[model samples]
Target: MDTLCGFMRDIGRHLSKPVVMTAEGGYANPVLGFDPAADRVVLLAQPRFS
Candidate 1:
């Protein structure tokens, strides 16, 4: 997770636009903190299929 977060932070340095993050596949491991690079984050509950 550290590697992944490091990559996101590295990428964020070059981006001028606002970064929005979707917390996917992360509920299992549960990262309690939001990414510093993200301007906003969208957290989804477990999926419900019809």
Candidate 2:
């Protein structure tokens, strides 16, 4: 996760607009947290497939 955040920061720095990362469609457990320093929201959840 740290690696992902690092990549996001690096990419975000080069871009003019804000960056929002979202993950979808998985059967793993969710990870919920907030990074105040980066002002980033990390959300992980499983997708509902019928």
Candidate 3:
């Protein structure tokens, strides 16, 4: 997780843009708190499929 976060941070630094993290279903909490590079975290409700 730390490694991934580091990589994301590096990418954000290189791109000079705020990275947005979208949560689908699993691992939402960690992505919200752990990702420092993510400027915004969007939590999406589960979609219902017909």
Candidate 4:
């Protein structure tokens, strides 16, 4: 999954750092999201690993 991880890395470069450490911004492929109030963090993907 090197390619996948690489893509993630690239996407990460575009994201803005969260003001609050507990928050995250990654919900789309090549994106990220984290929330302390939610009690979970998820990286939404296209579901197609093509």
Candidate 5:
């Protein structure tokens, strides 16, 4: 999660628009807490953690 936030912040510096994030293949992990750095998060499917 720290890596993701850091990457977002680094990329956001170059862009004029807000960052929208979506992750794949992280269903096995717990749901992530929201980060203020990201303007929006788009989850296309429900995550199954088991």
Candidate 6:
């Protein structure tokens, strides 16, 4: 879990947007931006499917 978090942090820091920590430990909050744009994040307390 630590390693995964580290990687996530690295990715988040490299982006210009915020990467929130979801209730599921970053599940619904995915890394947005497919092209060469600033990355964005969106985290929810619960998964939509749940």
For each candidate, what is the lDDT?
0.45, 0.54, 0.48, 0.40, 0.50, 0.46
Candidate structures ordered by lDDT, highest first = 2, 5, 3, 6, 1, 4
Residue pairs in steric clash, candidate 4? 25-32, 26-31, 26-32, 26-33
Q: What is the lDDT of residue 47 in candidate 6?
A: 43
Q: Summarize candidate 1's per-residue lDDT along 12-32 as a digit string, tens digits.
A: 555644333445865454432
Candidate 4 has an lDDT of: 0.40
Compose the digit string of candidate 2's lDDT tens values, residues 1-49. Answer: 7877766656666663344554375325444434445556455445569
TM-score list, all predictions: 0.35, 0.42, 0.42, 0.30, 0.39, 0.36
Off by over 4 Å in 5: 23-50
Model 2 worst lDDT run, 10 consecutive residues: 26-35
Per-residue lDDT value at 16 in model 4:
34
**Candidate 5 — what's its lDDT?**
0.50
Model 5 residue pairs with clashes: none
Q: Model 5 misses residue 36 by how many Å?
A: 9.7
Q: After superposition, how far is residue 6 of candidate 6 from its true place, in Å?
A: 0.4
Residues 1-50 of candidate 5 have per-residue lDDT tens digits of 66875566555555634454545766554333333455433343466699
Number of the top-ranking candidate, with lDDT as the measure: 2
Candidate 1: 10-residue stretch with minimal lDDT: 35-44
The Cα error of candidate 4 at residue 5, in Å, is 0.3
* Pairs in steric clash, model 2: none
Stronger candidate by TM-score (1 vs 5): 5
Candidate 4, residue 18: Cα displacement in angstroms equals 8.4
Better of 2 and 5 by TM-score: 2
